[model samples]
Structure formats: C-alpha cells, structure tokens
Target: MSSNAALLFQGGIGVIGLVAMLLFGIPVLLVGPGLWPSILLGALGASLTYAALLLLTRVPGLFPENLERQMQGLYDFASSYSPVVLILLSLLAGVGEELLFRGAIQGWLMANTDPVTAVLAASVLFGLVHYVSFTYFLVATGLGLILGAAYVLSESLVLVMVWHALYDMIALYCLLRFPRWFGVRIVDPVTNRPHE
Candidate 1:
C-alpha cells in the first residue's frame, strides 16, 4: 500500500479500536473518572521516557544503524505532509495504540491477573504488534513498560494519551528538523568508539 494509504488505514483502525474499547471495555473494567494525581504522574512518565531516549541516543552503538535508517526513511515519508497532517497522525497513533494496549488489554488483564503481569503482558503485546525488528520490538517493549507503569501509578489514560502525543510530536519535529543527529556512524563522545 501507499504510505498515505497505510497511514489512513492505521488511523482508521485505531479509531475503530478506541471506539470499541470505550463502548465495551470501559464498562466491563469499571474504570472510574480520571484522577488528577494519576494524570500528573502519567505526564511525568512520558517525559521520563523521552528523556531516557535522549540519553540513550548519546551513547555510541546503543541503537542499531539499521533502525536509524528505517526511522529516517519513515521521517522522510512523513515530511511530505503538512504539519497538521503530521500532528493528526501522531495523535491517531498515540490514542489508538494506548486505547488498545493500555485500555482494553491491560484492563482485561488486571481483572484476571496481578498488575505487574498485566502490564508486562500488555507491553509484550504492544512490542509484538510493531513487528519492526527485534531491536525495535525491544525498544517498544521498554516504552510499553513505561506507559504501563504510568497507568498503574496514575490510573489515568488521558494523561498517558497526552504524554504519548506530545512525545510523538517532539520526536517527529526532531527527526524532520535535525536529521544529522540520528546518523548511525558516529563517535561516541564519552567512550571514543565508533558507533557502527
């Protein structure tokens, strides 16, 4: 499929999943109103995840070059669109993925298992759905762990949604505006070693 078509398909699927979760899963989970504290914690969690990525990027050979190339290719494709489209796409990804992984799956798991197990299961599923690569899967799983922890702490999906959306926007902007920073072959400033 064309990139645009793929994005549309993803967004449409996400919307459908979110709606289904809201209509069916919410009542089944007995989810209550959002708590301010949980929301704040969720925001913190998202910020921390972004910060962690920033730190990781600074380390030489931390992430595979192939991943950078793949990400750059994606960024190049996304760069063809307007800012509004990018924002909307990011929002779609954030909302749709969170709804399915955190809201529906995690909620269901919490009902039958412990919170830790639920979070891990949901996180693993989240990683698997990406189907990018083992490295990417691991990265996604780590991010999922952060998201899950935030949910457990704040019990607020909205907070995580905002966090995820903001994170995506920041990442998209960086990838578009500063492509050089993501190069695979570079000297690790701290270790003085080649990244590749």
Candidate 2:
C-alpha cells in the first residue's frame, strides 16, 4: 500500500484508540515528565530487540523457512516506502497501538487486576493482533511486554509510545538496511542490490 494510505489507515487506529479510551472512560493524561530518559530508554529497547533478533536467527531450527519467507515479503513491502514515511507510520502505530493496548486495555486491566496480569494480558492481545507466524507472535508479544514495562515504570503512555515507535522504526531500518543481520539474503531495496 502507498505510504499515504498507510498513514490514513494508521491514523484510524489512533482514532479507534481514542474512541475506546473515551467509551471506557480511561483517563487520557497518563503522559508525565522524563522526556529525555524516555527517548534514551526507548532507543535502548530498540537496540535490545535488534540484538534479540540477531541471536534468535542464529539458533538452528528455531526460525523456520516459512517464517523467514513471510518476513521477507513484509520487508519487501516495508522497504518500498520512504524512510520518513515509514518512521511516520511507526509513530502512528506507536501512538495508536500503545494508546489502545497499554492506555486503554492494560489500564483497564490494571484497574481491575494486578500489574503483572495487566501486562501479560495486554501483551498477549498485542501479540495476537500482530500474529503472522508463531515466532512472530512471540516476538510481538515480547515487544508488547517491553512497552508495558516502560509504561509501568514511568506511568507514562508517552514513554511507551516512544519505545514502541522507536522499536518499530529501528526494526524496519534494520530489515531494509541489513537483511543479512537476520539471516535473510534479499535485495536491499534502497541500493537495488543484495547485501554484501
């Protein structure tokens, strides 16, 4: 899909999150201070995720051929867009998804349940929605856990939003810029040639 269309679609997610927040009567101002720390922490989360992917891909028989194929297909689509557009999409997804999953669903769960339950429940839901393969489900769930932890730590949706968005943006950047880092051998869309 065109990046513009992707933007519109992602924007709708933010709207849905907002509607859910309002309908559920969840407070919207969970955003707090600590902006600098949030950015650094978000970047760290992205780095850790990248390292995990590298390590996981190296484990023999762990990442299946089919899952690798699916990921390649996704990378092809993601690499078709401009970096700026992709980053924007990441931001939208971060805000929209974190808002609903963390702010609304997790927030509601925390109100009714314990923090651990809320994080696990919301992370599982996040994983389910992003499920492409079992491995991917696990990875997405792991990412959700990271975001949820950030939220719990700072009580700031803004922090998790930064973390989630940075994680996505970094992942996309890595997938396109260094496919072999994840054990894939595909054409680098930017250079129109395979990675060396």
Candidate 3:
C-alpha cells in the first residue's frame, strides 16, 4: 500500500480503539468505586515502567540511538500545550484505554480463569485493539504486557492509566512536533537509503 494509505489506516485504528474503549468503559465507573484506584495505579505503574526503560537505555552500549534527544523533542511539544490540555489528554488516554483493555477485557478474563492466563489473553487483545503496522503491533503487544503486569502487580488500574497517558503524550508530542528527533525522515521510501 502507498505510504499515505498506510498512515491513514494507522490513524483509523487509533480512532477505532478509542471508540471501543469509550463504549464499554463508561458503565464500569457507575458500577463501583473500587475500580478508580486500580485505574490510577495502573497509570502510575506504566509511567514508572517508561522511566525504567529510559534508565536501562542509559547503560553503555544499551541504547544505540539518541533516545534522550527524542525525549527532549517530545517534552518540547508537551510544553507547548497548556496545562489543561495536557491534563485532558492524559485523562482520556489513561482512563479510557485502561478501562477498555484492563478493566473490561482483563477483568473479565480474570473472573473466569487464572490470573496468568487472563493477563495473557487480555494483553493479546490489547495489542490487537490497536491494530496498526506489524512493527506497531509488536510494540503495542509489549506495551500491553507492561500494562497488564501493572494491573496484576498492584491490582490497580490507576498506575497503568497514568503510564499509558504519559507514554502516548510523549509519543504524540514527539511525532507531531519533533519528527526528526525520532529518526523519521519523510523521504521517498523507494529511494531512501542510509548514508555510508
């Protein structure tokens, strides 16, 4: 498929995921108060995981690329927005996604099976929910595992929600405002090549 087509498809997937989450997540909030803390913890846990990943990359010969530079670019974009917008973005991403993936799917699975099996099933569904390119799918799967673990580890969705929001905000900010930092160059794929 053409690059434009591929981009459009990816965008579509993101929208679909958002919509699905909204459709199923709102009711859970009405049912009980306990779920809120789980959501909060899930978000926080995810954010911490990201920090750990960054630190891991700092070890010698660990991170080959300039990941820190990319992070700075993301920060730059995030800084551009007002505090309100940032908070809203974080809420929507953290709460919405966790509710759908962990709250709905994982919660259901755990009700009927072992925690390990439930997490595995939920993680796979989480990955599939964000269906994009193959590489994106792999990344999403890895992310799902992290999010799932947060839920199981703390039995809280709050951590994962925060983590998911921060993760997406950083990525969105980087992509929208600092494409170059991420090593993305919009050259013709047919003729693109590395410098020797």
Candidate 4:
C-alpha cells in the first residue's frame, strides 16, 4: 500500500483502538484507583527495556548501519524542535500511537487470547503497522514490546500514556540539550562503530 494509504489505514485503526481502551480501561481505573504502583513499575520496565535495547545496539557484531542512522536522525529531529513543539508532539503521539498500539490492539488481544499471546500479537501488529524502514520497524517493535508489557503489568492505560509522554519528552530534551553526550554520530549497528 502507498505510504499515505497505509498511514490513513493506521490512523483509522488507532481511533478504534482508543475507543476500545477507554471503554474497558476506564472501568478498571475507576475500580482500582490505587493501582499507581503498577503503573510506576510499568514505566520503569519500559525505561529499562529501552535502555537495554540501546546498549544492545552498541554491542559489537550486532548493530546495523542503516538502523543507527535512522536513530540518529530521529534524535536530531527531536532535538531541533522547540520545547513547546516537543510537548505537542509528545501529546499527539501519546494519544494517537498509544491508543492504537497499546489501548485498542492490546485490549482486543487480552480479551480474546491469553496475556502472553496478546502482548506478542499486539507488538507484532504495532510493528507491522509502521511499514517504515527495517530499522524503524525494529525500533518500533521493541517499543511495542515494552509498551505492551507496561499495559499488562499496570492494567491501566493511563500509566502507559503518562510514561510514553514522559519518555518522549525526555528524549526530546536529551536530543536538544546533550546531543553529543548521547552520541550524535550515527553508528553502524552491526559493528557498533561510528559510520563514516
């Protein structure tokens, strides 16, 4: 499918996912307002997963060059945007992407199948829906796995939403403020060395 067409399709799916999540998640949230701990744990879990992935990419013999460039580009773009712009971007991403991938898709999977199957299936779908370059796909899939696990652990969409927003905001800040510290150069994923 054309990129535009694919995006539109994904957008539609996202809307559906949001609605479903709100329907089921709200009740859970209302019943157990004290599930904040789970939510916090979920956020921590996601952060660890992301860090691990970054470290893995730095490991020798496992990195992909194209993937590294893509990551660097993403960091550069986020770093370039103003704080207000980044906030807006994060809000939109948290609402749209989270709703579609974690809320709607994950909700459906949890209802129809076991949690393990649901998480794996939803993560795959989330990854496939991007239809971007391979590196982008891998990053997104890794993110999906982290987010999916968060949802399951917390059983609260709100926690994942907040975590997602916070994560994006921090990434944007890091990209903008400490670009060099974060390794601005694109590294070859396979060799874990800077790409020349």
Candidate 5:
C-alpha cells in the first residue's frame, strides 16, 4: 500500500481511540493516578504477551492449519512495508485499540456490570474487531483478555497501550523476519529473506 493510504488508515485507528476515550473519560492517559506503577506493569504485561506469542507460533498442532495461512498473509502484507512504517502502524494499533477496547468498551462494562463480565465482553468484542479467521479471533480474544487484565490490575489505560504496542512491534518484526516460525515458507520480496 502507498504510504499515504497507510497513514490514512493509521489516522482512522487513532481517531477511533480518541472517540472511545472521549466517551469513557480516559483523557488523562499517561497522567493518570497510577502512571509510574503502570509503566512497570506494562513491561510485565508485554513479557507475558511475548511468551504467549512464542507458544502460539512454536507449538505443533497448537493452532490449526488455517492459522498458518493467516500468518502467511500477515507476513506477506507486513513485509511490504519499511520496518519503520510497520513499527508506527503497530504503535498506533496499540494506543488506539487499547483506548477503544480497554478504556471504552471494558471501562463502560465495568460500570454497568461486574469486572469479570466487563473483561470478557470487551475481550470478545476486541476479538471480533480483528476477526480474520476463527483461529485469529480466538487469538485476538485471548490477547484482549491479557490486555484487559493489565488494565484492571493497574487501573491504567496507558499500561495496556504500552504493553500492546510493544507486543505488536515485536510480533510484527518476528512474523515478517521469521515466517517459518508460523509454518510459512514464503520469502519476503522486499526483504529478500524469510517466507515469501
């Protein structure tokens, strides 16, 4: 895709995040009460997420065959972009998606229902939003649960944002750089390496 098109999509994601924050009153962002503590918690969350990613990709028969196709598509698409653009896209997704999913969806649910209910419902919605395949939906939902737990534990939207962004950045790098990890074998024409 063209850079301008990518930027436009990135901006749309950010706009959605802002809208969610506005609706749910999460404007404080990094200035929220537990900022310092959340930072450490975010790092911890990222570590846990990374472990999950590794397990999902590395374990045989853990993910269905379709997931290999899903990863192959992701690798092909991601490998087309410059690494910097990919990082920026992942960062936007982290911040924007967290704001919408954790800050708004889960936050509102917490107010209207129980905490566990809120997390599950929001996680389901998060999974639905990123639905590329059933396997992908499950993966996204599981990831959402992790992020939701981080948000609840720290009571900080920024924590999940940081955790998510770091995880995406690293995951994207790995997905593109090591397609074989996900049972893919295509070499990225742009990078002249990895699965194409």
Candidate 6:
C-alpha cells in the first residue's frame, strides 16, 4: 500500500479501537468533562513526560540500544504521516487506553485493592501491552505510573486521557521534526539508508 494509504488505515484502526472502547465497556459519564484539576493535572503530567523524554534523549546511553532503535522506528513511521493523521491517532490512543486501563482496570482494582497496588497492577498490564522490548516496557510502565498517579490524585479520567494524548503529540512532534537532537537517524525501510 501507498504510505498515505497505510497511514489512513492505521488511523482507521485507532478510530475503531476508540469506538470499541466506548461501545463495549466504558460509561459515557466516566469520560465526561470535569473541573479545574482535570485540565491542570493533565497538562502537568504531559509536560513532565515530555521533559523527561527530552532529557533522556540528550543523555547518551541512558536508554538501551534496542529500546532506542525501537523508538526510532516508531518515530520514523510517525513522521511518514501528516500531522493531522498523527494527532488523530494520538487522540484515539489517549481516549481508548485511558478508558480501558485507568477507568476500567485501575478503577475496578482500586475498589478491591490498595491504591498503590491498584496503580502498580494496572501499570504492569499497561506496560505489557506495549511490550516491544524490555526498555520500551519499562518506559511505558513508568509512564503508566505517572498517568495512574495523576488519575488517582486528581480523580479525573479525562485528565489522564488528555495527558496521554498531549504527551504523544509532543513526542511525535519532536521525533518527526527534530530527529537529530534525539540522536535518531531515520532510515528508509527498504533501502536501509538514512532518510533525507
């Protein structure tokens, strides 16, 4: 398939995932808008995540080689798409993942377990889903911790969703627009040469 077609297909999958999350389980009310803490905590969490990633990228050897390669591959793929498509995918991921992981899984666990246990449990599962490599898993797990804490402390699912989405957007932007700063060398998949 053409690159643009591939991106559109991926976007379709994201939309379907979101719709399934909404239709299959999550209550409409759970994702509903809330007050100040929601927006505040969301932006705070996303900004913190972006800052951490930027710093980590600058510090060579901070991330495992395999992890770096995996992340570079992801960024390369993302950069192939238009900004609008990337944003939609990011939004879908934010909504779908937050609804399932935080709203459904963590929320349910919190009822039966301690807050710490609930967060950890949910975070572990969250990490497992992104199991590309050990390093990627750990990074995702750490993100889950931050997102979970934000959700628990603020009691706002919407907030975490926004955090997750904005965090993704920032990451995508950096990876696509500033690969050199992050030490990423995007290569053509077929030719295995540096992408111009």
Per TM-score, the best of the predicted structures is 2
Q: Write the per-residue lDDT of candidate 2 for residues 9-81, one digit (tens) a residue.
A: 8888888888888898876436565678766776777678777776777788875445677668778788789
Q: Distance from true position, residue 32, model 2, in Å?
A: 4.8
Cα lDDT listed for each candidate: 0.73, 0.81, 0.61, 0.65, 0.79, 0.77
User: Using lDDT as the measure, which candidate wins?
Assistant: 2
Local distance difference test, candidate 5: 0.79
Candidate order, TM-score descending? 2, 5, 6, 1, 4, 3
RMSD of each: 6.5, 3.0, 7.8, 6.8, 3.2, 4.1
Residue 22's lDDT in candidate 2: 89
User: Residue 120 deviation, candidate 2, in Å?
Assistant: 1.2
lDDT score, residue 47, model 3? 59
Quick one: RMSD of model 2? 3.0
Q: Which portions of model 3 show Cα errors greater than 4 Å?
A: 1-48, 51-90, 186-196
Give the distance in Å from residue 176's predicted Cα in candidate 5 to where it truly belongs.
Answer: 1.9
Can you write out model 3's per-residue Cα lDDT over 1-196, one digit (the tens) per residue?
A: 4434434554454465456556655222221225666555545655566666545645765544555454444455555566566656655766666776777777766766877887888788777876544444555677888878767776656566667888776556545555554454443456776322
Choose 5 or 6, whichever is better by TM-score: 5
As a TM-score, model 2 comes out at 0.86
Better of 1 and 4 by TM-score: 1
Candidate 1 residues 119-179, lDDT tens each?
Answer: 9999999899875777778888988888787777766777667677777778788777766
Going through the candidates in order, what is the number of backbone clashes in each? 1, 0, 23, 5, 4, 0
Writing each residue's lDDT as its tens digit, candidate 6 over 59-159 gives 76777755557767787678767788888778877877787788777776787788899899999999998888888888899999988887887777889
lDDT per residue for candidate 4 within 6-47, as digits (tens), equals: 345546655776577777662222112245764565467547
Inter-residue clash pairs, candidate 5: 186-195, 186-196, 187-195, 187-196
